[model samples]
Target: MRTDGGAAAVELTVHDEPCRDAAEVIDDGLGTANEAAAPMHEVRALQCYVRSADGQVLGGAVGRTWGLCAELQQLWVAPTHRGQGLGTRLVRAFEQRAIERGCRLGYLETFSFQAPVLYRALGYEVAATIEGYAPGIAKHLMTRVLGGS
Candidate 1:
């Protein structure tokens, strides 16, 4: 393809599965641009996990922190571990780490079928809601201040 009055050529490809190379290229390009816009934009992964006595994974929280903001990308708990407060613990651990990293706020998206109630109990307030995100479901965007900041 050509663009910008035919001054630049671009190629696009679709993959049937996850493409790490393509993702890396896109991440690199965006990272460079973001760094130019915000010199302090150093993103770092932050994760917390719970394990059973035999070292089996039970629950986890995955997120990233940049500047004063943290984004919770994923949270999961084994079915057997649900209702035992493991999810709450994982979230607390994740938030504590972000606080240690100097993050003042955190945000995440959760589906109606997911742990929106749990998040609310942990002080996350819904900032936005998307109706019909899935069949009979809604998506909620939530945010909270960490460490009273």
Candidate 2:
């Protein structure tokens, strides 16, 4: 996902059914109400992928932006595929995509059940912490500057 002040390009090396299905289901759930009321789609989404050398899917990340700020909506690496630098690679890829779209900053929220540590290590700083964002989960709001380096 490295950029050289040029147009953004996405490398979708893999596409698995589970992830695509989940995204469709979630989007359907959220978009139903909006569709009934507005009859339009107003949001754009992005998906970045990482693949093994032999063409197997390693992992990927997903995100979206409204304007100058982008929200990293979700990132997932298969349990057996973790710790192979896929997450970091996907992040760098998405960052490049966001920066190319004129994004200046990026942010993401992770719960205690997820990897806030990974986010921190990826140069995202804790912007806010919610004691109980979910029933038993602590939520960390993290942010990073895009194209700063």
Candidate 3:
């Protein structure tokens, strides 16, 4: 390895048991996260992947549930596939699964340049907004009460 800065500022080593070491580190990290999050909610993770008719991978939704709330961590649709309702379907399917898991509310945060309006049309209300979240951007946190009567 090479750097323009001081080599003494960095220390590099190789682990003979890379997999075992990584597994332990992952476990420890999850333990730390769960210690803070588990008590407040039931840990449930979910994902939904979209595929083309001929089996090309597109985009999808991935999120998790905590307590009675579910969050949409990520939602993406291929640029060529956008404006075709794929994003909406993915979100609806994800929320349906969250509902099945007993989540009563659905929430997500997106940049101001993203689909906050689409979410609003789907009944999500703005919960919060952070200005200048990214120089010329803002982050909008939105939430909606889920479940049926």
TM-scores, each model vs. reference = 0.79, 0.66, 0.73
Question: Once superposed on the true structure, which residue ranges of model 2 sit more than 4 Å away at CA?
Answer: 1-42, 53-56, 133-136
In terms of lDDT, the poorest run of 10 residues in model 2 is 9-18
Clashes (candidate 2) = 1
Residue 78 deviation, candidate 3, in Å?
0.2
Candidate 2 global lDDT: 0.83
Estimate candidate 1's alpha-carbon lDDT, on a 0 to 1 scale: 0.91
lDDT of 2 at 119: 85
- Whose lDDT is higher: candidate 2's or candidate 3's? 3
Query: Across residues 1-149, which tens digit of lDDT does each residue of candidate 2 receive?
Result: 44445576554444554687768887998888778886355445878987778987768788887677788989999889788887888988999988888889989999978989898888899999899566888988999999976
Clashes of each: 0, 1, 0
What lDDT is obtained when candidate 3 is compared to the true structure? 0.86
For 59-107, candidate 1 gives per-residue lDDT tens digits of 8999999999999999999998899999989999999999999999999
How high is the CA lDDT of each candidate model?
0.91, 0.83, 0.86
